[model samples]
Target: MSLASQRAGLSRLPLRAAAFVVLTCVAILGVSGWREWAARDAVLKGAETEMANVARSLTQHAEDSLDLLDSGVVGVVSRLEMDGTGPSTIAKLGKVLEARKTAVARIHSLAIIDDQGNWLTSPGTIASTLSDDTFFRHHQLSPKRDAYVGHPVKSVLDGQSVVTLSRRFNKPDGSFGGVVLATISAGYLSHFYEQFEIGRNSSVALVHGDGLIIARNPNNERFVGRSVADAPLFRDPSLQRPSGAYRFKSPLDGAQRVSFFKRSGRYPLLVLATVDQDELLAPWRAAAISRMLYVVALVMLIAIIGAVLVRQLQRGQRMAAALVEKEAHFRLLAEGSSDMVTRIGLDERLRYVSPSSNRVVGWRPNQLIGTDALAGIHPEDRPHVQAIVDAMKRGDMDEARLTYRNVHRQKSEVWLESTMRVTRKDNGTVDGVVAISRDITEQKNLETRLETLAIEDSLTGLANRRRFDERLKEEWARAYRDRSSLGLLMIDVDHFKSYNDEYGHPAGDACLRVVAKVIAAEVQRTGDLAARYGGEEFAMLLPNTDAAGCARVGERIRSAVHDAGLVHASNPAACVTLSVGGAACRPAFERTAGTDSLVEAADQALYAAKDGGRDRLMMSGEVTTLLPKASGQ
Candidate 1:
């Protein structure tokens, strides 16, 4: 051999020794990595399954608490409204809230709060210490539902985290009254997570859809309420695995660890199981060193045989490298497409996120990779979106198109039209959903504007006759159902034919506009609509407003029209006055009343107003005594 060959020969002994050591280390690393991956995956799956069971168990336990609360408040409100009394109401509310304290320990107290924000009762020493609470402020304004569950908050009663469920009571007229508020404990949630059997360095966190950390186990002093929204696993663009191992510096311990993550329902929750990387590979590392020493001793006895064997292995490695390159190239193309692609699980979490997310949602690819995709939807659209998702999960609907408003980055709202279809695997299992959302706010707004223009009157800004009649029909049905009162006012400009005879039609038009404005201003209440019935006659439809309220509005309109300073000399009626006649009668929905009869009732009242000295109001019930005008006059 040449001198270089001789040097290579001398180095061959050490090189063989070193090659055995390196190969042994690589094999050990591969085996240890595989085992660590499996162990971490198992730990996450077990913990997540356990936590899900805990959530179910706690839901059952809390069910009775919620139902009891619903029953108690319903009874209390019913009695209060029926009796029209407030004396024993507060005491009854306090008793019910105190009674449930054993089941829900976090409730400081229970009380009734009116719409004006005055608490009727309080629990324990809190009543003596503080006089007012915002809990009732929010509850009174809320719609009357079974119960209003407040977001989790620190209790004023006990200084512990809890949620309050308030039930609203309505007045006899269907107006909202005060609310009965009951606070519920958060202890059940903590108890639920405790059963998960988290390892020494393992943790489970519940994050809100907005990334607010709701709760966690092995509670870190700093990470409990903080948003891990900026973490690389949450913000990076390359993460697309459903349940995979990844290395990241732990926010709590500040040590590099391998974590396996599984996301919960599109509710902004993530379950992570982590272990220190060095600790996981410790056993395999030791085994690898031991194997390298044994291989070095064997290689010394057969150097020439090892050289041929290494050359064949190198050729095989080159072939494997070429295949890996092709696979990677295709994966990049699939992930980087323009379509808004996602893989959703049966549980409604995102299993995969494509690079298209950056353009579609203003989020980097990894920002929502393992996040609950449902949480990204607008609150108003959640039910519909979840329904479709659930249907697909149950194999009901295959494709669906839904449009809903989504909040953009700068707090502006944008409407998106999402087209979603089911994705299935070759083995006939659902992989997830692939959806494309295109901005459609402009289109929806245009459609809405066109619909509004069709329904609304252009000049007077009141509902047209069509809309008014539709509303009257709706009110008629409601009044019939509740056995409540309904009133209609037919306002006719006094001697409009004579006024148009004297002044030009344009002046008559101006007078009509002014009268419409006055009539509209007088009858401004919920369920009250003023619309041009036809010609100069404007009709006001009032539901739930009794005869007294209608009379008050009628007098106000009479005064407002006279104040407008328009002149009408016909029949010596007051200057520019409207002779308004109201028919106050509860409409029957099922048993029909003739339209002519209803108009006749109002028309009779108008004649009564005209005879009772114009610029006056007349009701259907009092028309006979109010006016006895001769038909010819």
Candidate 2:
């Protein structure tokens, strides 16, 4: 062949080789991309299946709980019909209601009301008549024998949100004889829903057929009883089936989510389990991006090799330098991340720490490098971090996302959420872990503050009535277990309405604050609690205290308030004086002497104190007698 022609053929050879390499690279990436997409679809499908199963399980559980509650109500109804509503029969009914309430953790209260909506038997005192309540009216109007679960409402007894399940009882003439009620706190279902770890921005909800949200995780009190009848989750024909999945935007929070829903087989209830689409696909997107980068890099490297074979050593060196530049770019991206990026070695030492460590944990890269990464973890969180690290090392977990506390340079604890992946060798041997951590201390602190606001009274800085009720129940149960006396003192500001009308609302509030402080000071035991029961009323719960002790404390509280000398021009005493009543009893599981009875007794004594004379403490008994005068009195 001629020299020019041979040279042309050789150049064409290189060109042909480059074209072939490019096509092969494209083909490989195309197949890999298809596989990755398939994998992503599989992950999503698996998640949907899992969520469906969760929805079904939760629905079944809710149905079973309701059925059990309904059975209890039915049994009570039968007994009431057989025994009638005499004092003895009411006492027996009270015992039965108490036993049911004790046995069922979810039941907040159990009561039977008369035709006039007066409670015939209750676990606690019914603070207000439920004559106008929806459930009460429903039972009075509709003679349905089925148990009806009502929308959430602030319970009349303790003022916490509760879902009431009521069954109507009939008189001999078949007229309504009021309803037997079983209340479950909406907080109970929310708390139960929190047990499942779905994902960030995920939610689980139990909704009634009428579209009232009975309970939900990420529990917002405002939304608990709200109706979502017009929402797509309820209105869409596709979602009305027994069980299904769909993508919809949440009406409550306005977030788009993949929702799985199941209708209860027994009750007019439904369970919804939702996961945010962004969160659900986040891992898959990351994996796809990583795979795409790997494919691109491999194609670039193959092209470089093909050029090197065509153009000898000089071109090969340039292409190698280009590859190095790409590596440097990746390193720059990692180091520039706001999150602390770290790679640990097989020896459990940090092989690399991103520069962001200084911003995250106030530690320099060199300070963290070559050191045990878990050593900086808070003592309480070290074990969990160690377990995750150990799992990564053992290849038991290929990826893990964990939240833990880390010790900052100032000795303050900082919460960090870390996403980590296990690195492996070509032979599939475990190498180390690569982790990215972001500080979440502020988020956690905000959550804590929000939680505090929910349970605290902004005015008196005491636990609100809701918290007080919860603590009282807990203490009552504990005291019952120990066979110890539980004392409850009810205090009311004498002529408080007149004070409010005379002093103006703000000054009246200040007077109440002083009274709250006095009560808190008098009940200073660690387990004791003082709370603003309502406007112009306060209560103190004394665990392990007897009637005499409670009376002494009550007297001290009254004396302290009288001494504070906040003038109340409208009162007979001309000062803010308290009328205190106390009752103490050993809580009994089988008898009617529960927290409610103690409260009722204290209330009766409080009324007696007001009737005898203001500014005195009274103890409940056959004949209410005044407490001995304080030293000054």
Candidate 3:
């Protein structure tokens, strides 16, 4: 019965072992290849997030620079229009301009140019007709009244590359009197981008909405002021989005890149943060190759181990010890990995845990074995984690990855991420589950910080315009749903330009900071938000507030600033004061309804307060206000 049959079975072992080795290699290749793809996706997403962060930071820098220029130019224009165009007035203004240029290092030049090709500050530029200048023509012809930013040009006085930011003033008779011109060094602005640590071949740029490159990092002087109108960033679909990210091949160097672009809120400007795709993926590519090589070695090791097991089976007595040795060999493989590995039984108890648990989660492998698998996870995250495990046990899923929090450890939060797979018996029925986990607290903290930076203003440490816009939209929807009142206060520092003019920009900054603190201290409600709206302007948004209540809050903020007693020589009150205007309304839900009317009304009242002597509060709405009725009432 035995000799021939045993001989045939022994002969078939080589073919069976070869088949098993091939199948194991195929499975390893499939799983490892999927992981490689996921790694690439993670690398690309990280680049996208980094580019977004850099773009936002550059946008803020550009905004602050423009604000500084606006403050100086506006102050000069106001003084010239009111003080008259006499020779004495022109002489006095010229001296003031020279002083400002000296005080602020960033200001290349500041001048008042007449309608007739004459420069009040510089006698040399008189021969060069200022009347034909792009900035001059913009102010002379366009009545838009906002500050105008012209293309970069070589300064006539010194041949330095400069960008002109100008505003026009009118005579009391409504005649075009002259233009206030301020130039800032384009090099200074572009150089600000060099501090970022983006890869070598990567670049950053500031582009006009009309597709002009105002400045660029990794700078070439020849590239400044060049038009990139046909670049992917300025193309049709890209232009349609205010801010977005995309992948494209650069026309300048033909390098593929992952780039992010954002448009500035108040200006026709955009910021581009481009990352070179090759450099971005270099580390990931190297790691991926290493991993595939490791998989190949692992497959060969498994085949050799299986052949030895078959040899032990032939001897019959050594089979039991060989199986135990194989288990230990696989354990060594798990321990060599960076993650903490664990195996769970159907009873949801840990059957085995890798030694790396001590490093990853501060728990020894022996201490975790036989314990409930979900016990260490936070209560809120346990249910979902268990659901994933159960689904895998039922063959509904073969693999899953999840991130969750751990139960309190020593006095700090711990975030953990897990990649899990279903373990099966030779009969193909699910036995239990196997998992790999690693601590991800650092990553979680970094993400939180990035989110905060996106919303908060770096200078004043207050809610920035972006945060305010997001909150405004959210509050608007809530107000509409409840038929509740939303109150808004528009606060502007009174005669701020004159203050900047008298004390210089540094003192002006300190004065604004003091006022900002005073305004912030008045809004005590969790729902009320106070934001730095823009240069010298602050806003307080009060939800469920009536016009009277909003006016009271404005009065408190005004009184606080007055009490702070920061001196402002140019202000009529002899102190820094605020012109505050409040508007409140019960929102009626409609598809097209928005906060535009409320903003407009508050703005009108703000202008009225400014015209009616500076330091006062004005409220916009009926004295007898009607409230939305509740169903019971």
Candidate 4:
């Protein structure tokens, strides 16, 4: 009986050994294949990151160049605004333009065009009309006065290609006056693109949001100014985002590329940087092939020692059981934990969702698994969230924290602040991401409400001092840039202390509210600001307004208060009256002083008004003008 059983077992030994060898070889191939796949993924992600950084660098450089051109153009525009485009001014402007163009190395030419697009002056030898140019047509048709960056075109004066950054100037009556054009040579930008060290078939370019290739590296003139409007990247809704990256076949050359693009927040400019996928993965492919060959050799060696792996087979089963138990423990903790935990793949699909998702975002675990992680994200916030995820996937960061809005299953928008960690494979390459998000809607709302109250005056419903100071600083910078005037008016309730003592505090507050209302109503311009500076005193900020305009507004306020007819028996006028003072100054680019000087001068004028009489408006000596005394005075 024993001889038969032993013979049967001995016969099955070779078959069992053969099966072990085959299974071991298959396992080695599978693991090696997965590692090679991860290596390729790493290569692609690294290439994308490199492209993104290059795109960002190019974008910043472009913005700096455009900004330099803008400053030069703004000065010329201001001159044309202050002084008409008469022959004398044009002759002087031509010389000024030549000097400026020489001083600014980036500018190829500077010219002033008439309202009809007649070139009034050109730094080039030949003056030419730009009546049919895109820039001229844009300024003529659109009332917007912001700087416009036009497509590449051959300059009529020099017969060379150039990109024009133009601005529209206005007449004294705010009518369309003309355009100030600053030209940047295309050749110079091409030279600037030469510094990048991208490999073969790679490109760096400046693209317009409308899909015009404004400029490109590798010195491809044929690609410049070409329309790529129908390209996948341009057609995608992501074009509206400030910055993003995409991988697609080039519509121009049909080359596959992992193109990274960054869009300018201020201009219609796009900086594109790309790397040829095949070239970028060349090294990875070589290494992967060699590693697979090694795996094949190791499989043959394992086949000879198949019997020796019996003990390892038993150990592997034990380890697998332990891992299964550990995974179950993790699930238990995830389900019981208060915070919602999720694992998201690079495709933005949820790999794992915890039970707490129901309590967190009003979705069950089953409802979220295998669904797009971004489906619940707010439309406006998805771009930023996607960028953060991309950065982690690209190995730029190991952990990230962000706050975003999520649409709850109940149809409510809830703010969620999440802390995310990049999950990695054993090869140290990225796997996906693990994120823990908690509801922050309540905290965010409270913070927003508190911020609003911080800058508002509760008593008079006007801007408080903090807000006034902040706005004045910004307006001062704007006025300094445009070389325009900034006016400030200080108003004080005449005999306010006496009125408060006689009529009680409540009545005094009511009077202040009424005064604030009058000040706000009188200063109604888009750039105007009326603030309750402090108790019983208010301030009005008028940008782009001259001294006479400020005095007129001050007079209106005083006369309106006098007409209000609020009784004040303790005062000499027997009614509430305002002592108003106004001062204006054309902000100078050469000045180093801040807006504090303007406020101090206006305050001095208000004291003068109060000293002369209780209810009168006084103008500072910046301009020789003063309104007639108010009726109460």
User: Which 10 consecutive residues of model 4 have the lowest summed lDDT?
Assistant: 624-633
TM-score of 4: 0.45
User: Worst ten-residue run, lDDT, model 2?
Assistant: 623-632
| Residues 324-355, model 4: lDDT tens digits | 34357667877788889999987879988998
Please give, for residues 1-633, the per-residue lDDT of candidate 3 as tens digits: 233234445657665766776788789888999999999999999999999999999998888888898998899989988997788988888888888888887887778888774677666433242223888888788877799988877655565567778899888988888888887777887777889988888899888778888888876466777888887677767456878887888776688999888899988889989999999999999999999999988988987887786666556533423433436766898888888899988889998899888778777888899999989888899999989988998999989999999854353558989999987765678878899998898999999999999998777778999999889888888998898889999999998999999999999888888888888888798999989999999999999998889999999999899877888887778898999988887766333436666676777778888888878998876312311122112
Q: Write the per-residue lDDT of candidate 1 for residues 1-633, one digit (tens) a residue.
A: 233234334446545665875566566656756765676566555544554554444334345555666666677677767865366766765666567655555444455666665656653523432333544656556664556654455545555555456677777887777776665445544555566553455555544333445455656323444666777767766644444455688776686666565554322344555555556556656865676566555644455565666666656555544544433554476476775666676667776667766666767767887778887678988898888888887778789998887766554677778788897755666657777777677798899998888777877777888888788878877887897777778888888888888887888888889998988887667889988877788888888866787777787888899888787766465478888888765555324453344456777887899888778898786322223231111
List runs of model 4 lying over 4 Å from the truth.
1-23, 123-132, 157-159, 238-240, 300-633
Preferred candidate (TM-score higher): 1 or 3: 3
For each candidate, give its TM-score against the true structure: 0.44, 0.47, 0.47, 0.45
lDDT to native, each model: 0.65, 0.82, 0.81, 0.84
- lDDT for each residue of candidate 2 in 79-147, tens digit (9 for 90 to 100): 777777789988987887787788889888788888897778753544352323788889888979888
Query: Which regions of candidate 1 are displaced past 4 Å?
Result: 1-341, 345-347, 351-366, 394-397, 497-508, 567-575, 588-596, 611-613, 622-633
The candidate with the higher TM-score, 2 or 4, is 2
> Cα deviation in Å at residue 234, candidate 1?
52
Stretches of candidate 3 exceeding 4 Å from the true structure: 1-323, 589-593, 622-633
Q: Which wins on lDDT, candidate 1 or candidate 4?
A: 4
| Candidate 2 similarity to native, TM-score | 0.47
lDDT (0-100) at residue 50 of candidate 1? 50
